[model samples]
Target: MTSHQPPLWRRAVAELLGTGLLVSIVVGSGIAAQQLSPNDVGLQLLQNSTATVLGLTVLILMLGPVSGAHLNPVISLVDWALGRRSGTGLTLPDLGTYVVAQTVGAIGGSVLANAMFEVGTSISVKDRATTGHLLGEVVATAGLVLLIFALAATKRGVLAAPAVGAYIGAAYWFTSSTSFANPAVTVGRIFSDTFAGIAPVSVPAFVVAQLLGAAVGLGLLLILFPSAARNTGDIVLPHSAEKTSA
Candidate 1:
């Protein structure tokens, strides 16, 4: 938002490209894992989570300079919501563009992943919206939001890349739904009928759960660190104009 920062268009493209690649990594690795370890579900998850962890960390480090790397809708939404009072973080207009870019990037990434794997893009038939899965989404997303903002609030934004990636990797194993905590990623996964895909029918509930989780995360942040909202602009990582140029 400063003179030295990248323009909105450039930042939006960064978000689109970063989010696309992230989903590609997710879907591609899932397909590879399925083929590599055909019978062992645990092995498949291991491969998928490992790739996701590395890929996401790289994406955040690579793109955080441009867009603050708010790759998730809830992240953007929460940023806007929390910063409204402080007049910081993403503006309403920017939030809208970010979400659109993310959603488009997510779908494109899924399709690209299917193409890379030589699999036809089709709606996923994996029904994952069970009560346990929904509950897992809530926990996973709440934890994600809490982690990101907590880092920013504590001036540990430098650790966001690895910390967020590690939390997600752990959540993949602990959460029943494998922590598809992102709404855009969830929607994108609906296009690929792969091991990492989710049923289209489940996307609505998943998105709702994620939104609710964001609220819970914000509530927790306020309770534990009442001053957290003041640093909402730093969510995810520090992408100040000066740092970005450096």
Candidate 2:
């Protein structure tokens, strides 16, 4: 190994590349659902949701070993705030790097989706979210980020693929934003004209809602597992950190 650690830039680049890949899968799958549907929107939604879970599952399993598959900025920020990461570190600058990478990656992913699907603005924003919908989104995303924190923060229980996959699959239908805690993913969907795509104007609200959700999730997790506070050794390092070190 080199004497010096891989600079923060490489780690940041990995995050950007990984987020871009995830958005491509998410947006592309949404487009596929629309193209295959005739009038059965329920079936279309099922297809869209299924595609999302499968894509995310594989991405997590694959990238989880590398980037921690964070893809979601909220997840990264919360982890850093929790003081879980160690020798390698998760600094504010690191948080900035991750978010920037993920955002730029999301933009690239959205552009790719547009180029592939030829969607200009088939599905655009409607209006400011209603109080109920906003609340629902907040609750949903909070649960999502909490789940990430719970899975990463603790070490006693194993986070097998089936358990995590099922949880994500279930979360999608339950949330107003369909449990999209990833700001990058949320922003990228604006480029698509599919049922799964969000309107550009509506994206900011979703981001705010998710940030709130993450806070809620973190609170609940801490409350439920007070004992876990002592142990955060494993959760800190990005899944890829080990690889880069090796």
Which candidate wins on lDDT?
1
Candidate 1's residue-wise lDDT over 1-246, tens digit each?
Answer: 234556789889989999999999999999999999999999999999999999999999999988888889999998898898788888888899999999999999999999999999999999999999999999999999999998888889889999999999999999999998899999999999999999988999999999999899989988888778789767677766543423
Residue lDDT tens for model 2, 1-246: 323324567766767877777778777777777788868777776777787677766666665544455677887777676765343335678778888888899878777876777777454554436666677768876776666656655662236344455666786677554566678878777766666677777788878887898888878988986644443323322353342333
TM-score, one value per model:
0.96, 0.83
Cα lDDT for residue 45, candidate 1: 98
lDDT on C-alpha atoms for all candidate structures: 0.91, 0.67
Best by TM-score: 1
- RMSD list, candidates in order: 2.1, 3.4
**Stretches of candidate 1 above 4 Å error?**
1-4, 242-246
